[model samples]
Target: MSPELSFSGLSVLVARVAPHTVATVHALLRDGARVTVASSLDDLPTSLRDLAERGLVTLDPRADPTAHDVVLRGDPSTSPAPQPQPRVAPGSPDVGTVTLLGGGLGDPGLLTVAGIEAIRVADVIVHDRLAPLSALRHARDDVQVVDVGKIPRGDFTPQERINEILVEHALAGRNVLRLKGGDNFVFGRGGEEAEACTAHGIPVVVIPGLSSSIAAPALAGIPVTHRTLVQGFTVVSGHVPPGDPRSTLDWGAIARSRTTIVVLMGVATLGAIAETLVAEGLPATTPAAVVADAGLPSMRTARAALGEIDATARREGLGAPAVVVIGEVAALDVLR
Candidate 1:
């Protein structure tokens, strides 16, 4: 909804049906533009199919994108391979730069001003599933927005392929933005991406975000620490169960730490985590809480003692991309 902007006479071609792509198509249609979505029928979700059925959009995989007034590269895999570029001489002006931006807790409002500026100036944006796609409204109509988000236990873009996409776009003289949810370095694999960019001689910048580890619980009115109850906090990954060989966490030390405990990406294994912590000497009656879909209108919170928190969350139908808090603070809703 920009002032004095209209697409009444334009036809737009969107190359794929990604989450961000769908948002863009809707925006164009709202502006009175005719839109054609190009992708296989199998990739068309019910919403897109509804649009096609109503004759509001033309859905064709073989549509000639050149026929449209505007063509969007919605998915990197669907974009043409970047052609070779003339190498820049040493110490010469760098052609393109990459900005690593964190989206923060699934809310566009949580996205920092610097992050939005980066998006507005980017020629290509490579984003993750948890990142705020709504913020892409700030991007140019022609900016190539690629969805490389990884869904837990589901289809995802390989990290290797994502790295290649960043490098390819930078080498092609396009300013690239690698956007994700939460702080880039907090279990975000941002270090690896930064390293890749440095190795390839691409100038890279990182703008930190509010990590959901702290934000989610706060939004749910549960503080991770309180001066009288806990002096510090420990953030852990619950993606792997306690007994899994892949897990290097010392559940014993964590349980004995006697500090606020915040677990991220641990919803699926909360039962095992609680059991291990209690067996390792933590009190079974310790207060625990789960905040799901943080920073969203549908966000829900579930709370129980350490011994029953997992079942409580399950009974409440709460799921992942959640923050699990265990400590005295979980029993207090300071905001309430």
Candidate 2:
């Protein structure tokens, strides 16, 4: 007979093994396995009864038997061992290192105090296209600024090469600031760069800034979530893999979900995304909005139905660094 078990935070499966199955389970438990028997009080195996008598396992009668044959619940008190800290080399110059700082969503005023401070203290600033040039005015005149903008399908410094530059400048006793457009950790590949620094025994610090993902939409007067419109929201990366066989996203779930959908770096694949949503049962008339160059003086916004997004974006010339908002909340903007 199958038995189901439930405990604080564990799950276990058991089938008709043998009469001594309970003893085997008990041995496994003593060796640090948390087990629970979910069958009725009268249906427990003899081995389970023995373990229960010894207080090693608990028996609960309220579990479903058909769905789960046997259920073992683990103890929640135990946790894994802590990891050791990385060792730093002796006499390494701590003065020269890299700080990956986030430049907030194209607005110099949006920059945090710490971000401005980093700019003032940096000896060299390695920046991207998204970072506003006005923000750099705070830096010293002698501070070297290197533009490493990665244009799509254009001349660009590879990520590995960028990491090498940061390290080389730091080892040369120069305080380097790796200025990024938005939050470094959010789809910015900052983690990979941080790992590279760690592997080379170079110290790195991260300063997070406002990501354009939400700020861009907000600057365009579009709230990602509204209590009357959307109860929750989901942010996704629109950069799907080339020739990706497996579905990169579950469009059906997103379409059916009553939550706001925000897509970052999705302008190029806008048509495909709209089609996927429509095909997955989202209405073609669903409200959607796109904000381009958000938080900048040249910021432009376009609102349309799901079916009209692709054509509208093309006609309006809305391109990269744009934020896409999809859901009922987008429709409310018309009233505002």
Candidate 3:
């Protein structure tokens, strides 16, 4: 009683397994297009595998991308498939390069030209949750976007697993782009990735992005440094409270430094951070500010004296993925 599947002349090659990609493949299959996926059967969702068992999809890593009418990307925004590139068989002997790219804050507009170029040529993009999603829009239709975003204290792809995926894709002759938010070298664990690739003889490159530690504060109209306000600044991670064993920073030294202090990933422990600074000789009345969701449309900033900043940010409902700035300059609205 069902209508016959159509797509007599259309062929689709699926380069990755993602919610959008899988859904697209399902539609393509239902419409009778020949669908070939470049992933192992074990990697597919149950729904996709059911379709495969019904002779609707083919799993082939060596699938020739050009043979298909279109190559599929996971993002729905990339529909209509990009112009086909010179067909090359996946898993070819050609060694692919890996580019570690910084996605800047949350704004795609902040992505550097070099970073965009890298995305354009990448065969696979291994990205974090914070990376600018716009880069995915510019990727080739056949590009495989692997979401490895890490959520603070939530479900996330393990670093070891991410490292394995990069090496695996590159070894299969596919250019891999490792994209993360902020400058990759700035607590982004880029060094570990570079080391992983080079250990396997894969060539690696870096495209730096504007770090939120600096960009976020600036966008919120707070300068990290001012000649008359402070002589220098220190950037620290607030992932842990000051006295937690996991933290290696010396709060006393930071408090006594007499310079601007910029804290990243510190919103959860902002109160503790403020307390430690005050307990260590920093003035309780020092000006401070919290810039949340920088570069995005919903960005918000809350300012208060150092002792009250944590309470102020909470009262304002600011959350993680924010930057905290402490110094005399925090009170100055230079842009205003």
The best candidate in terms of lDDT: 1
* Segments in model 2 whose C-alpha atoms lie over 4 Å from true places: 1-91, 241-247, 334-336
TM-score of 3: 0.75
Model 2 Cα lDDT, one tens digit per residue, 237-262? 77773235754777778878878888
TM-score of 1: 0.78
lDDT (C-alpha, whole model) for all candidates: 0.82, 0.70, 0.80
Worst 10 residues of 2 by lDDT: 1-10
C-alpha root-mean-square deviation, each candidate: 7.4, 23.5, 11.9
Clash count, predicted structure 2: 1
lDDT of 1 at 289: 97
The sequence of per-residue lDDT tens digits that candidate 1 reaches over residues 94-126 is 658889998897678888999999999988888
TM-score rank, highest first? 1, 3, 2
Best by TM-score: 1
Q: What does the lDDT read for residue 280 in candidate 1?
A: 99
Question: Over the full model, what C-alpha lDDT does candidate 3 score relative to the true structure?
Answer: 0.80
| TM-score of every candidate | 0.78, 0.69, 0.75
Q: In model 1, state the lDDT of residue 251.
A: 96
